[model samples]
Target: MNTATHPSESHEKLWDLIKDIKFGMLTHRHATGMMHSCPLTTQNKKLDEDSQLYFFISRKSELASALAADANVNVSYADPGKDSYVSVSGVAAIREDQAKKQALWSAPAKAWFAGGVDDPDLALLAISIDHAEYWDVKESKMVQLAKMAAAAFTGKQPRMGEHKELNLS
Candidate 1:
């Protein structure tokens, strides 16, 4: 069976897989020289035909503070049941536009801000992705079984194929 897919096809497939999985891990570097990663709910906007960006967080968050100090950030997502994952590297900025806030707001978001649309603590974090790499197992259980069998038979290591990398800059 053919295992390789066209680069664009792989990129789209991975994006579709995780696009609806609302939560992702956002990583940022603090001034104290420590890297912090936290779970965040994200909303996406199609920046262009091929590229997409995410908006998240409130201004008062530690994660937002870290992003303000340093725009460089990384985000990761995965669906364990499907054995698919993505790691994205990007830059982030705090957006304070009222129109933008209104555009992205929803009933669920209101729970995060007590003051509603005019909440002073509300802040939009925009992530401009530079690149993303994804791993998708075509036959997850079968692959695990193959690995176990190989290790049991010859004491040899099993290797999965390379991840598909997409540059969306």
Candidate 2:
């Protein structure tokens, strides 16, 4: 299903699709113009009402430089267990928010930044979401396979899930 969500609903819907998915593949353009993707963990424990998402990454990494060169980026989130997938396109930038770093700081992150929130190499990546697409099929794998086989023999497209596209900005 490809449907347009009402402007009011889109914002909330986008958040619902991604709130629990802890990891996302953030893709950005490199200096060579080639797209590069790296897995990053969303530092926020809860998705704020705004579509923007937060991440913690190494300031010295190429990703940090990529964001500096080009803010346009995409973040993909997936949960195969629930058959829910989301792709978010947004502008990304590295921020030096000390309070945010302290609030989002975690023990696992300490392994990478021994200096903790004060680590010189630590950076906060913020994605100002502009658009998002999601596919949500709340069904079991076996059921989905059966549906696919049935649809194939019956010459019908299997209704996979509730898919929606949102223009967030």
Measured against the true structure, the TM-scores of the candidates, in listed sequence, are 0.81, 0.89
Residues 33-112 of candidate 1: C-alpha lDDT, one tens digit per residue: 79988887776543334454556577777777777789998889988877788888888888667887787777787878
Shift in Å, residue 116, candidate 2: 0.4
lDDT value for candidate 2?
Answer: 0.86
Model 2: runs farther than 4 Å from truth? 2-8
The deviation in Å at residue 70 for candidate 1 is: 1.1
Candidate 1 clashes between residue pairs 3 or more apart in a chain or in different chains:
none
For candidate 2, list the clashing residue pairs, or say none. Answer: none
Give the TM-score comparing model 2 with the true structure, all chains together.
0.89
